[model samples]
Target chain A: MNEGAPAGAELLEVRGLSKFFGDVAAVERVSLDLARAETLGVVGESGSGKTTLARCILRAIDPDAGSVRFNSANGWTSLHSLKEKELVPLRREMQMIFQDPFSSLNPRMTVQQILEEPLLIHGERKRGKRVAAVREMLSRVQLGADALTRYPHAFSGGQRQRIGIARALMLRPSLVVCDESVSALDVSVQAQIINLLEDLQAELGLTYLFVAHDLAVVRHICDRVLVMHRGRVVETGTVEDVFERPRQDYTRLLLSAIPSPDPDVPLKPLDRATLNL
Target chain B: MTAPVLAIRDLAVEFKTDTGVTPALSGVSFDVPRGQVTAIVGESGSGKSVTANCVMRLVQPPGRITGGSIRFAPDAGDAFDVVKLADRDPRLYDLRGGHISMVFQEPMTALSPVHDIGGQVAEAILCHRDIGKEAARAEAAQMLERVGLDDMERRMGMYPFEFSGGMRQRVVIAMALVCHPEVLICDEPTTALDVTIQAEILTLIRSLQHELGNSVIFITHDLGVVAQIADHVVVMYQGRVLEIGTVRQVLKQPLHPYTRGLLQAIPGVVPPGERLATIASVVGDADIETPHPLVALADGRQVSLPPAQLRRVARS
Candidate 1:
């Protein structure tokens, strides 16, 4: 494995991954390898199977076919075939951050209870140790310990998202799947969260499966990006190659749709005839 | 410059919640020139929606307009004060759908699930136009076609639920424009849509604006959309105007620290390893004083910049 190169040793290998809902194939034969400490972005519009792929990888939803292998301390383990009881320990190595901060966290639970739930479920026996770990993780997310006693409703959207990030990092997972985590936030607040994510990744040496619909966001954070269209991977390349010199027409269309903030550069709307819809 | 079609001066709104009276908007003033788009850009809770609501006289009880005036001047009519009008006044009905119309963020909520699309649109025309049902329905179908809805004559009979997200939005636009209002207020109109759909809607709005020659008040948080559509831009933060200028001036040469921070904070423009500048980092613990001096650009665009910042820009 080359430490300096963009590609590192494979931390996760997903082969022939497929998920079907009724007659629709939400995800189809998706195969990819996530390098250790590398951020891989999956870009697609709604119904393109990006969310389905993330859920299948996390075992939140069962895939109809294919295997997900993770490189563990002991050896490689098949995540898809593992029984629910046996998969609990492996879950600590992989965690997810959801899209909506308002609904993701429990409204009834205090910040402490929300963050410590995973630890308690995973059998961390010492109460003092859990409190210490929770406090430390809160600081990592740039939140104060004073937030622990307060409910989710008390905090703003940005702060609630920070708590979500803190909860995901509680177990110190090597792989963090952020599923449109910053999409709902205001632009300024989104920037703050993105910066925090980058800082945390550097400090913790984390691998990220950054899934988003926004092309600009994917370009900013990912080393490599995969463009999915109609449940199929249309293009996969480095961020520069995918964004600057897209090989597929769909990718080009997606890129053009991104409204640039610069007033000097005007983008014409895609013509109906060109789309061939 | 031509006289503004609508002018908002020193507007103030307060929400009386259980905790206390929280001021949502204070001293917000702007003008909507004829045949141009003015975008009010802000983050959540920055009073953008409240300003729009005040224009339509839709601000409910517990959320009252404490001060200021909204002046409406139609092309060939006497000017009137919108703020002074009572909620139950008969004149408000004429102004709302006749002179001003609005499209909300969520199309599904704005439209009725039970009502057929054509009937609803026709009803809007009937409210102000004194037209017969047949003529109103014909105008509704024509408006739907104008908004680029396919098979408009048949699709008008279908309920809103039958339409996709993008299609539903088109229906909403058709209904809003059916009355042929002088001003259209679109609040985050494309926020819920996919990117391609957003582009299409934007194009539709631009083309419709050109064809109808109506002034537009575009409320959005995305600077990208503002850059694309707005002739003039107003940047708001925490219920106060940070800066207001022509699109080119504000986006190209932002002077206020908050405006500058917002421009730098967008992700795609920065490289992968580089950190994005944040608002908190730019304005730490210091409240920016209001009523900054307005600097006139070479192109006649006005930017609100503090004197110190203006001096710094001049030196640099």
Candidate 2:
């Protein structure tokens, strides 16, 4: 359930999105919609085209077919048809956070530079205004002003992730796609980041496309979930429905495979009918 | 109680970095019961991996065992202290892979890209046994089949790159078990795999361990994995063993505050709309008060608490 937006307005809508690498259809005929301020989770195994779908939406990788319609401040914009130069301004409306905190951020740049790069690129040339924006974004992510001068190497995995989150939100984007954002962190740190993401979503009315392979993490944060298998969407439903009463056998297998933390509770057996050997 | 197959007592390990000697493990003690899966669980920098390295005597240079003994008892021979054995001692050759083998987290790197599957598996067998190349290859083929690899004959010729993540892991398992070692150390063996593949690997390991009756040292950070597989769990934090008990005792009724913090930190276990309990909320600041005393909770779970804090709680 999306909140804080107009009753029926969709933040993002995808129609028959597809990408192929050689003979492999990395993402095949995928369609999904995201309401404003809603967190739509895309879940699948490593080769399940979840990353391909995210990249296609971000236009980081060009897609072979289909349309990505975003309801921008101006109105609905067709992202798929736009050229590189035309897509430059629209890029400010959408941002992405990568999985590996260690490698994602430019190591040589200070936190201020990393956060301010986007604003500078989007043509905010005033030094004072850029620094102010950077400081404000840092505090929003719960980092102190001192972090502005520190390089990415100085921050811990959790802190680096916070910096990543702050950088993604610095541009004040309508939609932020987090690709396995917290997967690299430890359990405690993961919880901290997840909470931070939720808080930011509520505060800024930001729509999120949270992509991950971990079902439990997706269940914890997502409003609705999309399950992908072998480059195709196998199921899509509310988090409760997808997890509890999965329509697809593949979804059930994925849910069952999650190791239960309680020792007293036995592990769900691998459903052979679902697995199909 | 039956004597543990492997008994580690007051083990201390230190890494001699350029800065100084950093303690990796300090006075850690645990026992791997015969034919049971004993999990060493902890986050990064917690020394679980160091413990596994210690068991296999695979700790690289700059890291050394400072104190304590790792006594391993074989099914038919006298118990020997692993710590006392020299790094290159010929006797260690008989112990390392012959009796104690290891499986790593990433199977891609673990399995050689250049070598054929059968050749690698056969090499593991040949290292510990006085078998001919043909016999070793036959044994490797049989092992591959046991690990659920299809078309063992043709599959044996395949390289590591030819297999999927799950299949590569199976190949690694086949290599580790070819010698039928008494103790198998799996260091986050399934962390790189998908959920379904992970389940299959865990099941395969469990069933193989059952049939082979080997003691297993499973190292992982996920409590969910420890729940499904471990018979006994060792919770380590900053090189110290916080809690050592059955899986039920540790997972359901955790003794140590750190263990409790770890268990509570798992997402999706708690009901919706409620914030997941965090270790930061429990531990507060980084510096913990010293000389902690073990306190028994209402549910009979024992947890170490600072004496002054316990007294303050009592007075309040």
Clashes of 1: 0
Tell me the deviation in Å of residue B174 in model 1: 0.7
TM-score of chain B of each: 0.94, 0.92
Candidate 2: clashing pairs of residues: none
Residue B87 CA displacement from its true place in model 1, Å: 1.8
The deviation in Å at residue B35 for candidate 1 is 1.0
Worst 10 residues of 2 chain A by lDDT: A1-10
Which docking class does model 2 fall in? medium
**Residue-wise C-alpha lDDT for candidate 2, range A22-53, written one tens digit per residue:** 99999999988899888899998899999999
Deviation in Å, model 1, residue B286 alpha carbon:
6.6
**Model 1 Cα displacement at A103 (Å)?**
0.9
Model 2 residue runs over 4 Å out of place are A1-9, A271-277, B284-316
Q: List DockQ for all candidates.
A: 0.76, 0.71
Candidate 2: residue A183 lDDT (0-100)? 90
